[model samples]
Target: MATRVNVTVDAHLAIEVMLLTGTRNPQDAVELIVRDYLERAQRTEARTGDADDGRRSSDLQPYQPPQG
Candidate 1:
C-alpha cells in the first residue's frame, strides 16, 4: 500500500521541472527532487566529516581525490 502525500510547489517551477525531467507523473517528479536533495545532504555531511555510526562516504571509499 502506498501512502498519499500532499505538497505545495511553485506552479511555474513545477511546469519547468516536469518538462526538463520528461516525467508526467507527479510522484516521479517528487522522487527525483527528493533523491537530489538526499544526495546533496549526504555529500555536505561527508564534506564536514560528519561520521554516521562511525561510517561516512570516505569510510566507504566512494570518493577519489587527484594525486600528484
Candidate 2:
C-alpha cells in the first residue's frame, strides 16, 4: 500500500491545478499534475539524450581558406 501524504498549498494554486486537470478533487488534481510533470521530464530526457555523450571543443578543426 502506498503511504498517504498531507500537504498544504495556496487555495488559488490548487484551484488552478484542478481546472487544468478537470478534476473536482484537490488530491486527484495534484496527483495528475505531478504525474504529468514526471512523464514530460522523462520524455524530454529520452529525446535529448545524455549531456555527456562526448563531443568537445578540442575535437574541432580550424577552418582553412580555399586556394584559388
Candidate 3:
C-alpha cells in the first residue's frame, strides 16, 4: 500500500532528477530516488554489520555504494 502526501522540493533538483531518471512524473522520480536511497542504506548495513553496535566481523569489508 502507498500513502499520498504532498512535498515541496527545489525546482532545479526536481528537474535534474527527472532528466537523470528519465521520469516525466515528479512522483515517480521521487519514488525512484527514495528506493535507490533505501537500497544503498540496506546494502551498507549488510556490509558493515550492526550499525548501533559498531562491531563487525573480520570477514566483512566496508560497504561501498555503487557509482553510476
Candidate 4:
C-alpha cells in the first residue's frame, strides 16, 4: 500500500533530484529519494549496530553530484 503526501521543495532542488534519479515525474523523484535514504540508513545501522549517525564510513567517500 502507498500513502499520498503533499510536499513543497525548492524548484531547483526538485529539478536536480529528478535529473539525478532519472525520474520524469516529481512524485517519482521524491519517492526515489526517500527510498534511497531509508535503505542507506538501514545499511548504515546494520553495519555499525547503532543508529545512523549521518556520518560516512572512512572507507566510503562522499557522494558528489553528477557534473553536466
Candidate 5:
C-alpha cells in the first residue's frame, strides 16, 4: 500500500491546480502537478545532459592578447 502524505496549501493555489488538472480532488490535482513537473524535468535533463559532462572552469586559462 502506498503511504499517504498530507500537505497544506493556499486555497487559491489548490483551486488553480485543480482547474488546470481538471480534478475535483485536491490530492489528485496535486499528484498530477507533481508528476507533470517530474516528467518535464526528466525530459529537459535528457536533452541538456548533466552539467558535469561539460568542461570545468579550472580547465580554462587567462586570455592573452596577440602581439601584432
Candidate 6:
C-alpha cells in the first residue's frame, strides 16, 4: 500500500535533481530519494543494535548513483 503525499521544492532544486539523477519523471525522483534514505536508515538501525545483521560501518559506504 502507498499513501499520497505532497511536498514542495524549489524549481532550481528540482532541476538539479533531474540533472543529477537523469530521471525526468517526478515519481522517479521521489522514489530514488526514498530508497536512498531508507537504505541509510537501515544501516544506521543495524549499527545501533543488531549483532547478527552484520551491517557494520563499512557496509554503509556511500553509493554513487549511476547516471541514466
By lDDT, who's the top model here?
5
With a 3 Å backbone cut-off (N, CA, C), the pairs that clash in candidate 2 are: none
Poorest lDDT segment (10 consecutive residues) of candidate 4:
50-59
Better of 1 and 2 by TM-score: 2
Worst lDDT 10-window in candidate 1: 50-59
Cα-based lDDT for every prediction: 0.77, 0.90, 0.86, 0.86, 0.91, 0.79
- Which TM-score value belongs to model 3? 0.71
Better of 4 and 6 by lDDT: 4
TM-score of 4: 0.68
For every model shown, the clashing-pair count is 0, 0, 0, 0, 0, 0
Worst 10 residues of 3 by lDDT: 51-60
- Cα RMSD to the true fold for all candidates: 8.9, 4.9, 10.0, 12.0, 3.7, 13.4
Q: Model 1, which residues run further than 4 Å from truth?
A: 1-3, 51-68
Candidate 3 whole-model C-alpha lDDT, 0 to 1:
0.86
Every model's TM-score: 0.52, 0.72, 0.71, 0.68, 0.75, 0.57
Off by over 4 Å in 3: 54-68
lDDT of 5: 0.91
Give residue 4's error in model 3 in angstroms.
Answer: 1.6
- Sort the candidates on lDDT, descending order: 5, 2, 3, 4, 6, 1
1-68: candidate 1 lDDT, tens digit per residue = 97968888887777777777788976688678888999999999778765565755545765678989
Better of 1 and 4 by TM-score: 4
- Candidate 2 local lDDT, 1-68, one digit each (tens): 99999999899999999999999999999999999999999999789776676554556789989989
Q: Pick the candidate with the highest TM-score.
A: 5
